[model samples]
Target: MERFYRRDFINTLSGVRNAHLLGTLSYKKVPNLGLFNSVTHIGATPPHLGFIMRPLTVPRQTYHNIKAQGHFTLNQVTLGTYQQAHQASAKYEVDEPEFEAVGLTPYFSETHRAPYVAESPIQIGLELAEEHHIKANGALFIVGKVVEIRLQSHLIADDGHIRMDAAQAVGVAGLDHYYRPEPIAQLPYPRPGQEDKILKPKNN
Candidate 1:
Protein backbone atom coordinates (compact mmCIF):
# COMPACT_ATOMS: atom_id res chain seq x y z
CA MET A 1 0.00 0.00 0.00
CA GLU A 2 1.09 3.60 -0.61
CA ARG A 3 2.16 5.72 2.39
CA PHE A 4 -0.95 7.85 2.76
CA TYR A 5 -3.33 4.96 2.18
CA ARG A 6 -1.46 2.75 4.61
CA ARG A 7 -1.57 5.46 7.25
CA ASP A 8 -5.29 6.01 6.87
CA PHE A 9 -6.04 2.30 6.81
CA ILE A 10 -4.06 1.62 9.96
CA ASN A 11 -5.40 4.63 11.80
CA THR A 12 -9.03 3.87 11.12
CA LEU A 13 -8.71 0.12 11.60
CA SER A 14 -9.62 0.41 15.27
CA GLY A 15 -12.86 2.21 14.41
CA VAL A 16 -14.06 5.45 16.00
CA ARG A 17 -12.47 6.97 19.10
CA ASN A 18 -13.45 9.86 21.29
CA ALA A 19 -11.63 13.02 20.25
CA HIS A 20 -10.37 15.83 22.44
CA LEU A 21 -8.53 19.11 22.33
CA LEU A 22 -5.35 19.01 24.40
CA GLY A 23 -4.53 22.37 25.87
CA THR A 24 -1.01 23.33 26.90
CA LEU A 25 0.99 26.44 27.65
CA SER A 26 4.55 27.12 26.58
CA TYR A 27 7.17 28.52 28.90
CA LYS A 28 6.57 31.95 27.40
CA LYS A 29 2.88 31.70 28.40
CA VAL A 30 1.70 31.09 24.87
CA PRO A 31 -1.36 28.87 24.98
CA ASN A 32 -1.63 25.93 22.57
CA LEU A 33 -4.54 23.71 21.67
CA GLY A 34 -4.31 20.62 19.50
CA LEU A 35 -6.86 17.99 18.61
CA PHE A 36 -5.96 14.53 19.92
CA ASN A 37 -7.67 11.13 19.70
CA SER A 38 -5.21 9.17 21.83
CA VAL A 39 -6.35 9.94 25.35
CA THR A 40 -6.96 6.82 27.45
CA HIS A 41 -7.80 6.01 31.02
CA ILE A 42 -4.78 4.87 32.97
CA GLY A 43 -6.20 4.16 36.43
CA ALA A 44 -9.10 4.80 38.73
CA THR A 45 -7.50 4.73 42.19
CA PRO A 46 -4.91 7.30 41.24
CA PRO A 47 -7.23 8.99 38.79
CA HIS A 48 -4.73 8.98 35.98
CA LEU A 49 -4.95 9.48 32.21
CA GLY A 50 -2.49 8.99 29.39
CA PHE A 51 -1.97 9.88 25.76
CA ILE A 52 0.54 9.01 23.04
CA MET A 53 2.71 11.53 21.26
CA ARG A 54 3.99 10.87 17.80
CA PRO A 55 7.69 10.39 17.07
CA LEU A 56 9.88 13.34 17.98
CA THR A 57 11.66 13.56 14.63
CA VAL A 58 9.75 16.78 14.11
CA PRO A 59 9.06 19.62 16.47
CA ARG A 60 6.30 18.66 18.95
CA GLN A 61 5.15 21.78 20.70
CA THR A 62 2.65 19.97 22.94
CA TYR A 63 5.28 17.65 24.32
CA HIS A 64 7.59 20.58 24.94
CA ASN A 65 4.92 22.60 26.67
CA ILE A 66 3.76 19.72 28.86
CA LYS A 67 7.34 19.14 29.92
CA ALA A 68 8.06 22.79 30.55
CA GLN A 69 4.83 23.64 32.36
CA GLY A 70 4.12 20.19 33.89
CA HIS A 71 0.37 20.50 33.34
CA PHE A 72 -2.22 20.21 30.58
CA THR A 73 -5.93 20.02 29.91
CA LEU A 74 -8.01 17.56 27.87
CA ASN A 75 -11.23 18.99 26.52
CA GLN A 76 -13.67 16.56 24.92
CA VAL A 77 -14.66 17.53 21.38
CA THR A 78 -18.41 17.81 20.80
CA LEU A 79 -20.77 18.21 17.84
CA GLY A 80 -20.72 21.99 18.04
CA THR A 81 -16.93 22.31 18.40
CA TYR A 82 -15.39 19.52 16.33
CA GLN A 83 -14.63 21.83 13.42
CA GLN A 84 -12.65 24.21 15.58
CA ALA A 85 -11.06 21.30 17.39
CA HIS A 86 -9.96 19.87 14.06
CA GLN A 87 -8.58 23.20 12.99
CA ALA A 88 -6.42 23.22 16.11
CA SER A 89 -4.35 20.45 14.54
CA ALA A 90 -2.91 22.77 11.92
CA LYS A 91 0.77 23.59 12.18
CA TYR A 92 1.25 26.97 13.79
CA GLU A 93 4.40 28.84 14.77
CA VAL A 94 5.84 28.50 18.26
CA ASP A 95 4.67 31.94 19.33
CA GLU A 96 1.30 31.63 17.66
CA PRO A 97 -1.29 30.07 19.97
CA GLU A 98 -3.79 27.75 18.33
CA PHE A 99 -6.61 28.70 20.70
CA GLU A 100 -6.88 32.08 19.09
CA ALA A 101 -6.04 30.84 15.62
CA VAL A 102 -8.68 28.13 15.81
CA GLY A 103 -11.25 30.48 17.31
CA LEU A 104 -11.74 28.64 20.63
CA THR A 105 -11.95 30.45 23.92
CA PRO A 106 -9.27 29.74 26.49
CA TYR A 107 -9.74 30.11 30.22
CA PHE A 108 -7.59 29.28 33.24
CA SER A 109 -8.03 28.07 36.77
CA GLU A 110 -6.17 29.43 39.77
CA THR A 111 -4.44 26.14 40.48
CA HIS A 112 -3.32 24.92 37.07
CA ARG A 113 -1.10 26.69 34.59
CA ALA A 114 -2.65 25.05 31.53
CA PRO A 115 -5.54 26.65 29.71
CA TYR A 116 -8.97 25.04 29.24
CA VAL A 117 -11.34 25.20 26.27
CA ALA A 118 -14.42 27.07 27.35
CA GLU A 119 -16.65 25.62 24.67
CA SER A 120 -15.85 22.02 25.49
CA PRO A 121 -18.50 20.09 27.41
CA ILE A 122 -15.98 18.05 29.37
CA GLN A 123 -12.64 19.48 30.49
CA ILE A 124 -9.98 17.72 32.49
CA GLY A 125 -6.95 19.27 34.11
CA LEU A 126 -3.94 17.13 34.86
CA GLU A 127 -0.34 17.39 35.98
CA LEU A 128 2.43 15.37 34.39
CA ALA A 129 2.95 12.27 36.50
CA GLU A 130 5.20 10.11 34.37
CA GLU A 131 6.47 9.57 30.82
CA HIS A 132 7.68 6.48 28.99
CA HIS A 133 9.69 6.56 25.79
CA ILE A 134 8.91 3.79 23.32
CA LYS A 135 12.16 2.26 22.14
CA ALA A 136 10.78 0.55 19.03
CA ASN A 137 9.34 3.83 17.88
CA GLY A 138 10.32 7.29 19.12
CA ALA A 139 6.78 7.93 20.31
CA LEU A 140 6.25 9.05 23.91
CA PHE A 141 3.63 7.86 26.39
CA ILE A 142 2.57 10.56 28.79
CA VAL A 143 0.79 9.83 32.09
CA GLY A 144 -0.93 12.50 34.08
CA LYS A 145 -2.78 12.50 37.39
CA VAL A 146 -6.12 14.20 37.43
CA VAL A 147 -6.07 17.58 39.10
CA GLU A 148 -9.53 18.86 38.26
CA ILE A 149 -12.55 18.22 36.07
CA ARG A 150 -14.94 20.91 34.89
CA LEU A 151 -18.27 20.08 33.39
CA GLN A 152 -22.02 20.23 33.88
CA SER A 153 -23.16 18.36 36.98
CA HIS A 154 -26.00 16.65 35.17
CA LEU A 155 -23.87 14.95 32.52
CA ILE A 156 -22.68 12.46 35.15
CA ALA A 157 -25.03 9.68 36.22
CA ASP A 158 -25.75 8.78 39.85
CA ASP A 159 -23.36 5.85 39.61
CA GLY A 160 -20.52 8.13 38.45
CA HIS A 161 -20.50 7.00 34.83
CA ILE A 162 -20.28 9.94 32.50
CA ARG A 163 -22.84 10.09 29.74
CA MET A 164 -20.84 10.75 26.60
CA ASP A 165 -23.96 10.50 24.47
CA ALA A 166 -25.62 13.16 26.57
CA ALA A 167 -22.58 15.36 26.13
CA GLN A 168 -22.78 14.88 22.38
CA ALA A 169 -19.07 14.09 22.34
CA VAL A 170 -17.60 13.64 18.88
CA GLY A 171 -15.54 10.71 17.71
CA VAL A 172 -13.00 10.43 14.91
CA ALA A 173 -12.09 7.79 12.39
CA GLY A 174 -8.66 7.92 10.74
CA LEU A 175 -7.47 11.52 10.75
CA ASP A 176 -10.23 13.75 9.45
CA HIS A 177 -13.55 11.93 9.59
CA TYR A 178 -15.77 12.67 12.60
CA TYR A 179 -18.74 10.82 14.13
CA ARG A 180 -21.37 10.97 16.80
CA PRO A 181 -21.91 8.09 19.21
CA GLU A 182 -25.24 6.96 20.62
CA PRO A 183 -25.80 4.66 23.56
CA ILE A 184 -27.14 1.28 22.53
CA ALA A 185 -27.20 -0.82 25.68
CA GLN A 186 -26.24 -1.00 29.33
CA LEU A 187 -25.11 -4.31 30.78
CA PRO A 188 -24.47 -5.60 34.26
CA TYR A 189 -21.14 -7.11 35.31
CA PRO A 190 -20.77 -10.66 34.03
CA ARG A 191 -21.27 -13.42 36.54
CA PRO A 192 -20.54 -17.00 35.50
CA GLY A 193 -23.70 -18.58 36.90
CA GLN A 194 -26.13 -15.72 36.67
CA GLU A 195 -28.37 -14.69 33.80
CA ASP A 196 -27.24 -11.50 32.08
CA LYS A 197 -29.14 -8.35 32.88
CA ILE A 198 -29.32 -5.70 30.20
CA LEU A 199 -31.04 -2.41 29.56
CA LYS A 200 -31.59 -1.34 25.99
CA PRO A 201 -31.78 2.21 24.73
CA LYS A 202 -35.12 3.92 25.08
CA ASN A 203 -35.15 4.96 21.43
CA ASN A 204 -34.64 1.38 20.34
Candidate 2:
Protein backbone atom coordinates (compact mmCIF):
# COMPACT_ATOMS: atom_id res chain seq x y z
CA MET A 1 0.00 0.00 0.00
CA GLU A 2 1.07 3.57 -0.58
CA ARG A 3 2.29 5.51 2.43
CA PHE A 4 -0.78 7.70 2.97
CA TYR A 5 -3.21 4.91 2.18
CA ARG A 6 -1.42 2.44 4.42
CA ARG A 7 -1.38 4.81 7.35
CA ASP A 8 -5.10 5.48 7.18
CA PHE A 9 -6.02 1.88 6.50
CA ILE A 10 -3.99 0.51 9.39
CA ASN A 11 -5.34 3.06 11.82
CA THR A 12 -9.02 2.59 10.97
CA LEU A 13 -8.72 -1.19 10.74
CA SER A 14 -8.59 -1.38 14.52
CA GLY A 15 -12.17 -0.14 14.68
CA VAL A 16 -13.31 2.60 17.04
CA ARG A 17 -10.81 3.62 19.69
CA ASN A 18 -11.32 5.83 22.68
CA ALA A 19 -10.26 9.41 21.94
CA HIS A 20 -8.52 11.29 24.75
CA LEU A 21 -6.80 14.57 25.35
CA LEU A 22 -3.38 14.15 26.94
CA GLY A 23 -2.35 17.06 29.12
CA THR A 24 1.16 17.77 30.28
CA LEU A 25 3.33 20.60 31.53
CA SER A 26 6.76 21.55 30.38
CA TYR A 27 9.65 22.25 32.74
CA LYS A 28 8.90 25.91 32.26
CA LYS A 29 5.37 25.27 33.55
CA VAL A 30 3.76 25.68 30.13
CA PRO A 31 0.57 23.66 29.74
CA ASN A 32 0.16 21.43 26.70
CA LEU A 33 -2.63 19.28 25.34
CA GLY A 34 -2.57 16.67 22.59
CA LEU A 35 -5.27 14.52 21.14
CA PHE A 36 -4.64 10.77 21.17
CA ASN A 37 -6.57 7.63 20.32
CA SER A 38 -3.96 5.11 21.45
CA VAL A 39 -4.69 5.25 25.17
CA THR A 40 -5.56 1.89 26.77
CA HIS A 41 -5.91 0.36 30.19
CA ILE A 42 -2.90 -1.80 31.07
CA GLY A 43 -3.96 -3.19 34.46
CA ALA A 44 -6.66 -2.93 37.07
CA THR A 45 -4.87 -4.15 40.16
CA PRO A 46 -2.62 -1.12 40.42
CA PRO A 47 -4.66 1.05 38.03
CA HIS A 48 -2.32 1.56 35.16
CA LEU A 49 -2.84 3.01 31.67
CA GLY A 50 -0.61 3.24 28.62
CA PHE A 51 -0.47 5.23 25.44
CA ILE A 52 1.65 5.12 22.30
CA MET A 53 3.58 8.23 21.35
CA ARG A 54 5.43 9.05 18.18
CA PRO A 55 9.21 8.83 18.17
CA LEU A 56 11.38 11.51 19.67
CA THR A 57 13.11 12.21 16.37
CA VAL A 58 11.21 15.45 16.32
CA PRO A 59 10.19 17.68 19.20
CA ARG A 60 7.26 15.80 20.65
CA GLN A 61 6.27 18.22 23.38
CA THR A 62 3.97 15.73 25.10
CA TYR A 63 6.77 13.20 25.50
CA HIS A 64 9.20 15.86 26.63
CA ASN A 65 6.83 17.36 29.15
CA ILE A 66 5.85 14.01 30.65
CA LYS A 67 9.49 13.05 31.04
CA ALA A 68 10.31 16.34 32.74
CA GLN A 69 7.32 16.52 35.07
CA GLY A 70 6.56 12.80 35.59
CA HIS A 71 2.86 13.63 35.54
CA PHE A 72 0.10 14.01 32.97
CA THR A 73 -3.63 13.87 32.51
CA LEU A 74 -5.92 11.84 30.27
CA ASN A 75 -9.14 13.64 29.56
CA GLN A 76 -11.97 11.88 27.73
CA VAL A 77 -13.09 13.57 24.53
CA THR A 78 -16.79 14.20 24.25
CA LEU A 79 -19.15 15.33 21.47
CA GLY A 80 -19.26 18.81 22.92
CA THR A 81 -15.50 19.21 22.85
CA TYR A 82 -14.46 16.93 19.99
CA GLN A 83 -13.64 19.71 17.55
CA GLN A 84 -11.49 21.60 20.04
CA ALA A 85 -9.87 18.33 21.07
CA HIS A 86 -8.98 17.55 17.45
CA GLN A 87 -7.53 21.00 17.00
CA ALA A 88 -5.14 20.29 19.86
CA SER A 89 -3.25 17.85 17.64
CA ALA A 90 -1.89 20.60 15.44
CA LYS A 91 1.87 21.00 15.61
CA TYR A 92 2.53 24.01 17.74
CA GLU A 93 5.75 25.69 18.74
CA VAL A 94 7.33 24.71 22.05
CA ASP A 95 6.25 28.00 23.54
CA GLU A 96 2.69 27.70 22.29
CA PRO A 97 0.48 25.80 24.69
CA GLU A 98 -2.30 23.83 23.02
CA PHE A 99 -4.74 24.57 25.81
CA GLU A 100 -4.46 28.24 25.01
CA ALA A 101 -3.99 27.86 21.28
CA VAL A 102 -6.93 25.53 20.81
CA GLY A 103 -9.20 27.52 23.15
CA LEU A 104 -9.63 24.81 25.78
CA THR A 105 -9.54 25.70 29.45
CA PRO A 106 -6.67 24.29 31.52
CA TYR A 107 -7.61 23.17 35.00
CA PHE A 108 -5.27 22.32 37.88
CA SER A 109 -5.65 20.72 41.27
CA GLU A 110 -3.56 20.67 44.41
CA THR A 111 -2.52 17.05 43.88
CA HIS A 112 -1.15 17.27 40.30
CA ARG A 113 0.76 19.85 38.35
CA ALA A 114 -0.40 18.74 34.92
CA PRO A 115 -3.48 20.58 33.80
CA TYR A 116 -6.73 18.84 32.93
CA VAL A 117 -9.31 19.90 30.38
CA ALA A 118 -12.06 21.66 32.25
CA GLU A 119 -14.50 20.81 29.49
CA SER A 120 -13.84 17.09 29.66
CA PRO A 121 -16.51 15.06 31.40
CA ILE A 122 -13.90 12.67 32.77
CA GLN A 123 -10.39 13.66 33.75
CA ILE A 124 -7.71 11.27 34.97
CA GLY A 125 -4.43 12.18 36.63
CA LEU A 126 -1.53 9.83 35.91
CA GLU A 127 2.00 9.66 37.24
CA LEU A 128 4.63 8.42 34.81
CA ALA A 129 5.65 4.90 35.75
CA GLU A 130 7.61 3.53 32.80
CA GLU A 131 8.51 4.17 29.19
CA HIS A 132 9.58 1.62 26.59
CA HIS A 133 10.99 2.31 23.16
CA ILE A 134 9.44 0.33 20.32
CA LYS A 135 12.23 -0.66 17.97
CA ALA A 136 9.98 -1.70 15.13
CA ASN A 137 8.43 1.72 14.53
CA GLY A 138 10.53 3.91 16.78
CA ALA A 139 7.46 4.69 18.84
CA LEU A 140 7.41 5.14 22.59
CA PHE A 141 5.11 3.17 24.84
CA ILE A 142 4.44 5.19 27.98
CA VAL A 143 2.83 3.63 31.03
CA GLY A 144 1.40 5.66 33.87
CA LYS A 145 -0.17 4.81 37.19
CA VAL A 146 -3.59 6.31 37.75
CA VAL A 147 -3.41 8.79 40.60
CA GLU A 148 -6.70 10.62 40.43
CA ILE A 149 -10.03 10.47 38.58
CA ARG A 150 -12.70 13.16 38.32
CA LEU A 151 -16.07 12.53 36.76
CA GLN A 152 -19.77 13.04 37.08
CA SER A 153 -21.43 10.79 39.60
CA HIS A 154 -24.40 9.80 37.44
CA LEU A 155 -22.17 8.25 34.81
CA ILE A 156 -21.20 5.43 37.15
CA ALA A 157 -23.48 2.42 37.11
CA ASP A 158 -24.44 0.28 40.12
CA ASP A 159 -22.29 -2.56 38.75
CA GLY A 160 -19.25 -0.24 38.48
CA HIS A 161 -19.36 0.11 34.69
CA ILE A 162 -19.15 3.67 33.44
CA ARG A 163 -22.03 4.67 31.22
CA MET A 164 -19.96 6.14 28.42
CA ASP A 165 -22.97 7.10 26.37
CA ALA A 166 -24.29 9.14 29.25
CA ALA A 167 -20.92 10.84 29.55
CA GLN A 168 -21.06 11.65 25.81
CA ALA A 169 -17.60 10.26 25.24
CA VAL A 170 -16.44 10.20 21.64
CA GLY A 171 -14.46 7.57 19.78
CA VAL A 172 -12.08 7.89 16.86
CA ALA A 173 -12.39 5.92 13.64
CA GLY A 174 -8.98 6.88 12.34
CA LEU A 175 -6.61 9.80 12.58
CA ASP A 176 -9.30 12.42 12.09
CA HIS A 177 -12.83 11.08 12.30
CA TYR A 178 -14.75 11.22 15.58
CA TYR A 179 -17.82 9.24 16.53
CA ARG A 180 -20.27 8.76 19.35
CA PRO A 181 -21.12 5.22 20.39
CA GLU A 182 -24.46 3.77 21.45
CA PRO A 183 -25.07 0.90 23.83
CA ILE A 184 -26.54 -2.24 22.23
CA ALA A 185 -27.02 -4.61 25.12
CA GLN A 186 -25.52 -5.62 28.41
CA LEU A 187 -24.39 -9.23 29.06
CA PRO A 188 -23.84 -11.10 32.26
CA TYR A 189 -20.56 -12.66 33.30
CA PRO A 190 -19.92 -15.95 31.51
CA ARG A 191 -19.41 -19.33 33.13
CA PRO A 192 -19.48 -22.87 31.72
CA GLY A 193 -22.85 -23.99 33.10
CA GLN A 194 -24.34 -20.47 33.07
CA GLU A 195 -23.57 -19.79 29.42
CA ASP A 196 -27.06 -20.57 28.19
CA LYS A 197 -28.76 -18.97 31.16
CA ILE A 198 -26.72 -15.83 30.89
CA LEU A 199 -27.44 -15.55 27.18
CA LYS A 200 -31.13 -15.20 27.87
CA PRO A 201 -32.40 -11.63 27.84
CA LYS A 202 -33.39 -10.15 31.17
CA ASN A 203 -37.09 -9.41 31.65
CA ASN A 204 -37.71 -5.72 32.14
Candidate 3:
Protein backbone atom coordinates (compact mmCIF):
# COMPACT_ATOMS: atom_id res chain seq x y z
CA MET A 1 0.00 0.00 0.00
CA GLU A 2 1.03 3.59 -0.50
CA ARG A 3 2.35 5.54 2.53
CA PHE A 4 -0.71 7.75 3.19
CA TYR A 5 -3.07 4.93 2.27
CA ARG A 6 -1.42 2.55 4.72
CA ARG A 7 -1.46 5.09 7.53
CA ASP A 8 -5.08 6.03 7.05
CA PHE A 9 -6.21 2.44 6.74
CA ILE A 10 -4.32 1.21 9.80
CA ASN A 11 -5.35 4.11 11.99
CA THR A 12 -9.03 3.28 11.65
CA LEU A 13 -8.52 -0.41 12.36
CA SER A 14 -9.04 0.24 16.08
CA GLY A 15 -12.47 1.75 15.24
CA VAL A 16 -13.82 4.93 16.74
CA ARG A 17 -11.88 6.15 19.74
CA ASN A 18 -12.54 8.56 22.57
CA ALA A 19 -11.45 12.08 21.66
CA HIS A 20 -10.29 14.56 24.26
CA LEU A 21 -8.78 18.00 24.26
CA LEU A 22 -5.64 17.63 26.31
CA GLY A 23 -4.78 20.82 28.15
CA THR A 24 -1.30 21.67 29.33
CA LEU A 25 0.80 24.60 30.48
CA SER A 26 4.26 25.46 29.31
CA TYR A 27 7.01 26.32 31.79
CA LYS A 28 6.53 29.96 30.82
CA LYS A 29 2.86 29.68 31.85
CA VAL A 30 1.45 29.51 28.36
CA PRO A 31 -1.68 27.38 28.29
CA ASN A 32 -2.02 24.89 25.44
CA LEU A 33 -4.78 22.76 24.00
CA GLY A 34 -4.41 19.83 21.67
CA LEU A 35 -6.89 17.27 20.39
CA PHE A 36 -5.89 13.71 21.21
CA ASN A 37 -7.70 10.48 20.36
CA SER A 38 -5.08 8.14 21.73
CA VAL A 39 -6.17 8.43 25.36
CA THR A 40 -6.75 5.02 26.96
CA HIS A 41 -7.90 3.71 30.30
CA ILE A 42 -5.01 2.19 32.18
CA GLY A 43 -6.68 1.03 35.40
CA ALA A 44 -9.71 1.61 37.59
CA THR A 45 -8.70 1.00 41.21
CA PRO A 46 -6.14 3.79 41.38
CA PRO A 47 -7.86 5.68 38.55
CA HIS A 48 -5.11 5.79 36.01
CA LEU A 49 -5.28 6.83 32.34
CA GLY A 50 -2.79 7.19 29.54
CA PHE A 51 -2.27 8.67 26.08
CA ILE A 52 0.21 8.11 23.29
CA MET A 53 2.44 10.75 21.72
CA ARG A 54 4.41 10.57 18.55
CA PRO A 55 8.20 10.45 18.45
CA LEU A 56 10.22 13.47 19.54
CA THR A 57 11.70 13.97 16.10
CA VAL A 58 9.61 17.10 16.08
CA PRO A 59 8.81 19.35 18.99
CA ARG A 60 5.68 18.19 20.81
CA GLN A 61 4.41 21.05 22.91
CA THR A 62 1.95 18.84 24.77
CA TYR A 63 4.56 16.31 25.82
CA HIS A 64 6.98 19.01 26.85
CA ASN A 65 4.44 20.88 28.92
CA ILE A 66 3.21 17.76 30.67
CA LYS A 67 6.77 16.85 31.63
CA ALA A 68 7.56 20.35 32.82
CA GLN A 69 4.45 20.85 34.92
CA GLY A 70 3.76 17.23 35.88
CA HIS A 71 0.04 17.71 35.42
CA PHE A 72 -2.56 18.08 32.67
CA THR A 73 -6.27 18.07 31.99
CA LEU A 74 -8.32 15.84 29.70
CA ASN A 75 -11.53 17.46 28.52
CA GLN A 76 -14.05 15.33 26.69
CA VAL A 77 -14.87 16.68 23.21
CA THR A 78 -18.62 16.83 22.97
CA LEU A 79 -20.77 17.25 19.89
CA GLY A 80 -21.00 20.97 20.49
CA THR A 81 -17.24 21.38 20.70
CA TYR A 82 -15.90 18.70 18.34
CA GLN A 83 -15.08 21.14 15.58
CA GLN A 84 -13.07 23.38 17.85
CA ALA A 85 -11.40 20.33 19.36
CA HIS A 86 -10.36 19.22 15.88
CA GLN A 87 -8.95 22.64 15.16
CA ALA A 88 -6.72 22.32 18.20
CA SER A 89 -4.67 19.73 16.32
CA ALA A 90 -3.29 22.41 14.04
CA LYS A 91 0.30 23.45 14.52
CA TYR A 92 0.66 26.73 16.29
CA GLU A 93 3.56 28.71 17.66
CA VAL A 94 4.72 27.82 21.15
CA ASP A 95 3.35 31.05 22.57
CA GLU A 96 0.03 30.78 20.75
CA PRO A 97 -2.46 28.69 22.72
CA GLU A 98 -5.02 26.76 20.74
CA PHE A 99 -7.85 27.55 23.19
CA GLU A 100 -7.77 31.18 22.13
CA ALA A 101 -7.07 30.43 18.50
CA VAL A 102 -9.84 27.85 18.22
CA GLY A 103 -12.41 29.99 20.06
CA LEU A 104 -12.67 27.79 23.18
CA THR A 105 -12.42 29.17 26.68
CA PRO A 106 -9.60 28.04 28.93
CA TYR A 107 -10.75 27.42 32.48
CA PHE A 108 -8.41 27.04 35.39
CA SER A 109 -9.08 25.41 38.73
CA GLU A 110 -7.74 26.79 42.01
CA THR A 111 -5.67 23.66 42.60
CA HIS A 112 -4.31 22.80 39.17
CA ARG A 113 -2.22 24.92 36.83
CA ALA A 114 -3.39 23.11 33.71
CA PRO A 115 -6.36 24.66 31.97
CA TYR A 116 -9.56 22.83 31.11
CA VAL A 117 -12.00 23.45 28.29
CA ALA A 118 -14.90 25.36 29.79
CA GLU A 119 -17.22 24.01 27.12
CA SER A 120 -16.47 20.38 27.93
CA PRO A 121 -19.16 18.62 29.94
CA ILE A 122 -16.68 16.11 31.38
CA GLN A 123 -13.27 17.32 32.49
CA ILE A 124 -10.60 15.45 34.37
CA GLY A 125 -7.39 16.68 35.96
CA LEU A 126 -4.50 14.28 36.24
CA GLU A 127 -1.02 14.12 37.66
CA LEU A 128 1.83 12.50 35.81
CA ALA A 129 2.47 9.01 37.16
CA GLU A 130 4.70 7.30 34.63
CA GLU A 131 6.07 7.51 31.09
CA HIS A 132 7.58 4.91 28.81
CA HIS A 133 9.21 5.29 25.44
CA ILE A 134 8.43 2.62 22.90
CA LYS A 135 11.70 1.15 21.74
CA ALA A 136 10.43 0.01 18.38
CA ASN A 137 8.67 3.20 17.32
CA GLY A 138 10.07 5.86 19.71
CA ALA A 139 6.55 6.91 20.63
CA LEU A 140 5.83 7.91 24.21
CA PHE A 141 3.22 6.41 26.51
CA ILE A 142 2.29 8.88 29.20
CA VAL A 143 0.34 7.68 32.22
CA GLY A 144 -1.50 9.90 34.63
CA LYS A 145 -3.35 9.28 37.86
CA VAL A 146 -6.71 10.92 38.14
CA VAL A 147 -6.71 13.88 40.51
CA GLU A 148 -10.00 15.63 39.91
CA ILE A 149 -13.18 15.06 37.91
CA ARG A 150 -15.65 17.78 36.96
CA LEU A 151 -18.99 17.03 35.42
CA GLN A 152 -22.69 17.41 35.93
CA SER A 153 -23.90 15.32 38.88
CA HIS A 154 -26.86 14.00 36.93
CA LEU A 155 -24.59 12.40 34.32
CA ILE A 156 -23.42 9.71 36.72
CA ALA A 157 -25.59 6.66 37.38
CA ASP A 158 -26.14 5.13 40.81
CA ASP A 159 -23.87 2.26 39.83
CA GLY A 160 -20.93 4.65 39.09
CA HIS A 161 -21.05 4.34 35.30
CA ILE A 162 -21.01 7.64 33.45
CA ARG A 163 -23.65 8.20 30.78
CA MET A 164 -21.45 9.48 27.99
CA ASP A 165 -24.29 9.41 25.49
CA ALA A 166 -26.16 11.90 27.64
CA ALA A 167 -23.15 14.18 27.52
CA GLN A 168 -23.07 13.95 23.68
CA ALA A 169 -19.39 13.17 23.75
CA VAL A 170 -17.78 12.73 20.33
CA GLY A 171 -15.42 10.07 19.05
CA VAL A 172 -12.76 10.14 16.35
CA ALA A 173 -12.15 7.67 13.55
CA GLY A 174 -8.73 7.60 11.85
CA LEU A 175 -7.58 11.20 12.37
CA ASP A 176 -10.04 13.81 11.18
CA HIS A 177 -13.49 12.26 11.10
CA TYR A 178 -15.73 12.74 14.17
CA TYR A 179 -18.71 10.77 15.47
CA ARG A 180 -21.23 10.82 18.29
CA PRO A 181 -21.97 7.49 19.88
CA GLU A 182 -25.44 6.17 20.68
CA PRO A 183 -26.18 3.87 23.61
CA ILE A 184 -26.88 0.29 22.59
CA ALA A 185 -28.44 -1.25 25.75
CA GLN A 186 -26.00 -1.94 28.55
CA LEU A 187 -25.43 -5.64 29.20
CA PRO A 188 -24.99 -7.32 32.56
CA TYR A 189 -21.50 -8.06 33.77
CA PRO A 190 -21.16 -11.65 32.63
CA ARG A 191 -20.95 -14.38 35.25
CA PRO A 192 -20.53 -18.09 34.99
CA GLY A 193 -23.85 -19.84 34.22
CA GLN A 194 -25.53 -16.42 33.81
CA GLU A 195 -24.84 -16.01 30.12
CA ASP A 196 -28.50 -15.85 29.17
CA LYS A 197 -29.39 -13.10 31.65
CA ILE A 198 -29.41 -9.46 30.44
CA LEU A 199 -29.68 -6.34 32.53
CA LYS A 200 -32.51 -3.89 32.11
CA PRO A 201 -31.66 -1.22 29.54
CA LYS A 202 -30.19 1.98 30.96
CA ASN A 203 -28.33 4.99 29.57
CA ASN A 204 -24.85 3.79 28.66
Give lDDT tens digits, candidate 3, residues 75-159: 9999899988888899999869678889999999998889999999999999999999999999989999999999999999898
Per-model C-alpha RMSD: 2.9, 3.1, 3.4
In model 3, which regions exceed 4 Å deviation? 196-204
List TM-scores for all candidates, in order.
0.93, 0.93, 0.93
With a 3 Å backbone cut-off (N, CA, C), the pairs that clash in candidate 2 are: none
Q: lDDT for model 1, on a 0 to 1 scale?
A: 0.91
Question: The CA-based lDDT of model 2 is what?
Answer: 0.91
Per-residue lDDT over 1-204 for candidate 2, one digit per residue giving the tens place of the 0 to 100 score: 999899999889989988999999988888899889999989999999999998888888888888888999999999999999988888888858678777899999889889999999899999999999999989989999999999989999999989999999999988997889999989666778875565555675
Clashes of 1: 0
**Which runs in model 2 stand beyond 4 Å of their true positions?**
194-204
Candidate 1 lDDT, 90-156, residue by residue in tens: 8988869688788899999888789999998899999999999999988889999999999999999
Supply every candidate's count of residue pairs whose N, Cα or C atoms clash at under 3 angstroms: 0, 0, 0
Look at candidate 2 and tell me the lDDT of residue 3: 98
